[model samples]
Target: MSEFADRIRPHAPTRDDASARRWIYVPYDRLTDATGPLTEQPASQTGIVMMEALAKAHRRPYHKKKLALILASQRHFALKQARRGIKIIYEFTPGIFADGLEQATRHHRLSALTMMQPAEREMSLDVEEARVRGIPLQLVEDTTWCSTESDFDSVFAPTTKHFLMDRFYRRMRQKTGILMQPNGEPIGGKYSYDAENRRPYRGQPPVPERPRFHPDSITQEALHLVAREFPSHFGTLDGFDLPVTQAQADEAWSFALEHLLPHFGPFEDAMAHNEPDLFHSRLSALINISRLLPRRLIDDVARAAHSERIPLASAEGFIRQILGWREFMRHLHRRTDGYRQLPGQRNNSSSDDPYAGAEPSALNAHRPLPAAFWGRRSGLHCLDTVIDQVWREGWSHHITRLMVLSNLSTLLGVSPRALTDWFWIAYIDAYDWVVEPNVLGMSTFADNGLTATKPYVSGAAYIHRMSDYCGHCRYNPRKATGDASCPFTSLYWSFLDRNADNLSSNPRMSMPYVTLRKKPASELNELRKRAAQAIEELCHAQQASPQE
Candidate 1:
C-alpha cells in the first residue's frame, strides 16, 4: 500500500465492525448535502469520508486564507457530524482522490458509498475513477443548486443557438417565482435594476465596517497546519478571519443584510483605495462550502426587501448575481462541451473572415503574465492595490476584478489560461467552473465573444472615473504616449487598431471603429509602438524579479 493510503484511516466511530453496510463520501464542498445520506441510514451504519487532499492544494499556489478557510470549514463540519453520532472518516493524504477513496472503502468495510454529484469537472472525473476501480459508489443529485441538469437540458433543448443569459435568467425567475409580482411580472416592473447600480462612490455616506470573526481554536489549528504545509503559498496568514462554522457564516450574512445590502447596488461597480470590500457580501466561500445555501439566502433577501427595509434595486441587484449570473454560468457550462462550441467560432473557424478563420488551438494570448500579478508592485495603483489585497486577504470586490485586473490583462494580451489559473489560485471564491467562464469568456473575450458581447477593455479614463487609484498614480489616464502615459490608454487604442479587421464588422464595435478610422495613421502607429514598449517594459520587470 502507498504511504497516502496508510494515512487514510478512519478517525471517528472507532468500532471494529468489519461489516459496515453503507457509507457516504462527503467532499469538502458538499458538506450540507450529506444530510441526504445521514437521513437515509442510521448514524452507526452511515460513515462520512472527508479528505484533506494535499496533492490538490499544491496544484496551484493558493492563497493562505483560501487554504485555511477550506481546511477549517471541513474540520468544523466533520466535528459537527461526529457530535451528531455519525461515523466520520477524515483523511489527510498526499495522493490522488481515487487512492483516498479506495483506502476509505476498505477501512470502513463499506458495502456502498453514496455521494452527491460533484460541482467541478475534475472531481466528477475522480468519482468516475473510483467507480472503475470497482468501488460500489452511487451518485445522487446535488440538491444544493436551485437548477439541475434536467433544468439546463429543458432550457437548451429547444434551440441549437448559443445560450443567452438574460433569457435563461428570466426562465429561472419565472420558475422560482423569485422577485416577481403576483401577476407574474417582474417586481418594480423590471427584470434588472442594473442601470441603477453603477453610481461611483464619492466617499459621502461612510462605508460600514466589515464584520470579522476572531479565529477560534479550530481555525487556529487549521491556520497553523496550512502555514507549515504550504509556506511558499501566495498569500499571508496575518489576518485570517473567515467564518468556518455554520453559525458564524449565518452571522456574517446577517451583518451584510443589516449594514451593507442597502448600499450594495449603487456601489457595486465602485472601487476605492484601502477599501478592498466595498458593500460586497463576502459570503462566496461560505456559500461554496455549503455553510449557506443560495436559495435560502435569496429568499431571505427578498423577504427583507418586502418589508420595505432593503431597497428594490439592492434586492434586485443581489438576486441577479445569484439567480441570474451564477445559475446562468453553471447551466451554460452543462449545455456546452467546454470550448468546442464557443460563440462565434464554429469548428474552430469564424464564418465571417476566411483569412482570420482559423482559431489557434491554444489561447490567442502569447504574452507572459506579469510577476506583478503575484503581488509584486506594478506601479499602477489600481493593479498594485488589488494584488496586495488579494495577497493579504484573498478577496477583492468584482469591480476591481473585472474593470482593473481583467481589463489590464486583456489589454496586455496576457494568456487567458494563465490569467484564469492565477484567479483560481488567488481568490477565496474561485473554482475552475467559476473562473474559466468568467475569465476566458467574459474578461478576456478569448472565447471569441461567447460570454460577453464586447471585450471589457477600457482606457485608463474608465478606471480613473470608477476608482480613486488614478488620483495617486504617476501615470496619466489621458495621455497615450510619453513617460507619464498610462499603459491602458495606449493599449486601448492599439487594441482597437490591431483587432480592427476582426471587430470592424461587429455592430457593437462600430462606434470604436469609426473613432479608429478618424484617427491619423501616424497617431495610431505611435499608439501601437507605445503599447509594444509598455508590454516589453512589464515583461522585463517581471523577468528581473526573483522567482517565487
Candidate 2:
C-alpha cells in the first residue's frame, strides 16, 4: 500500500455509542459545500461516508485521466472534511457503489444517512434500493443546478415531446437574472448571441495558454492509485493538470476571465489542427465534478461582461452553456427518468447497461461504432486528430464533439447505444445526466427529436469551413464519390437519401431534402457506393482492434 493510503485509511472515528451519529454520503461528483449535505447537518453530529467502487470504475473503459481526476478530487475533499473534525468512513473497496455503502453502514453502525440526489441514474437507483431496504436515508435536493424540477415542469408539460432549449434558457435567465435588464428583458435586447459567436479563427489574436495545476503530493497519490488500479482504461495518465480543489478551480476560473474569455465566443466553434483547447474554458470537468459551482461562475462571468471586462458575445455564449444547456441536460435527464424511460430498454438487461437492448436509431443505424473512436487513425485528419486529442486528454471542445465525432458517427450509421457507450466511457466530463441527453437526444437524434429539434449531422463542407483539419486531410471536401472523397461528404448525402422519409418532414430539414432531391440518381448511386466502401473499411478496422 502507498504511504498516503496507509496514513489515511484508518482515520474513521471509533465510538462505543454510534447510534446518535447521523452520516452523510458523498458521491464522487458531489464534492462541493455549495450543495453538499454538510449544510444540512453539523460536523460534530454528522459523519461522512465516502466510497470508491473498483468494479464500477472498471465497468467501462473509462479515461485514465478521468479516473485520476475523480479519485484525487474526492480524496482532497475528504481530507478537507477530516481536518474539519468530521468523522469520515472512507472506503476504497471492491464491487459496486452499493456494496461499499453497505460495508460502511454495517461497519460504522450508520442507522440514518443523508445524501444529495446523485447526478447519475444508477446511483439514484442504488439510493432508492437502500431506502426500500429501510436504511433510513434522507435524500436532499440536488442544489448544484440553478433551476429545479419544478422550474422545468412549469414551462414544459409532462407530455411535451420536444424540450426547447431556448424556452428553458429564457426561463432560467428570468429566474437567475444572470444577463437580464432591470426591465426584465434580456440585456442587449437578445437572449442568444449564438449567431455572432460563429466566426472562424484566422489566428489574428494568438490563443493564450490555459493555466495548468501540477499534481501535488495528494494528487500524486491519487494518480498512482489510478495507475495501479485502472491501468487498462483508455486515455493517458501523464500530463494530469486539472484542478482538484476549490481554490485551484477558482484560480483556473480567474485565468479564463483574464486570458481565455476575450476570444472564447468568436472561436468557440472554431477547431484548429493541433490546438485542442482554443479559447474554450476547460471548466466543464471542474463544474461537473463540483469543484466549481455553476451559479457563482455564471454570476462572475455576467459581471465581467457588464463591466466591459469581456465582450457581451463571450459572456452570453459561456453563460448560455452553463445556464442553458447544462441545466437543461440535468432536468431532461430527470424528466426522461434518466435513461430508464428511454425507449427499447430490455427487461433482461442489467441496470449497469441501461441501453443494452436499445432499438435501432430513428434513422435505423445499426453498424458497430468503429475502432477509429478508440484511437485508431481513420486516415481522415479531422476524425483522427479529434480522436487522438480525446485519447490524450479525455476532452475536446463542443464543436469537435458535436460536428466532428457525433456528426461522423451519425452519417456512418454507427449504433446509437455503441456511440453512447463510447461517449460515457471516453469523456472526463461525461455522466448519465449530461452524456445521455447529449448523445441520444441531441447529437445522434437517437431519441428522434425528444431533446433536439433536428439532427446535428453535417457534411465535409461545414467541417472544412470551421476547421483547418480539412486543409491537411488527404480527402477532398468537394468530392463525394471517388477514393479521395471525404467520408463525411459522401455519407452525409447517403444519410439524407437513406432517411428522407423520416427527416424530410422536419421543418428545419426541408432545404436539405430539397438539395438531396436535386442530385441526379447516377451521382446518388456513386455516393452510396462510396459510403459502403467507407463502412466496409470501418468494419475491417473494428474487427482488427483488440478493444472492439
- The candidate maximizing lDDT is 2
For 290-386, candidate 1 gives per-residue lDDT tens digits of: 7888999899999988997899999988998888788777666555543445544555434453212223222257577888886667889889999
Q: Provide the lDDT at 476 for model 2.
A: 94
Residue pairs clashing, model 2? none
Show where candidate 1 strays beyond 4 Å.
1-11, 14-21, 33-35, 39-45, 158-161, 340-363, 544-547
* Cα lDDT of model 2 by residue, 1-548, tens digit: 76556656666768642566678888998898666678766777767888888987887879989999999899888888877777788887788777787777787777777888788887877777676666767888888878888999999987787788999999999988888998999999999999998877777688887778999998998898888887778888888998998789889999998889978898899999867788998889989988888998898899999999999999999999999999999998887775446544333224465534334377788788887887677899999999888888899999999999999889988888778888888889998889888887789998778778889988899998988898898999988889999988888988898888899999999999999889998999998999989988874564422243
Using all chains and alpha carbons, the TM-scores for the candidates as numbered come to: 0.92, 0.95
lDDT of 1: 0.78
In model 1, the Cα lDDT at residue 154 comes to 71
Clashes of each: 0, 0
Alpha carbon deviation, residue 228, candidate 1 (Å): 1.4
Q: Which one is best on TM-score? A: 2
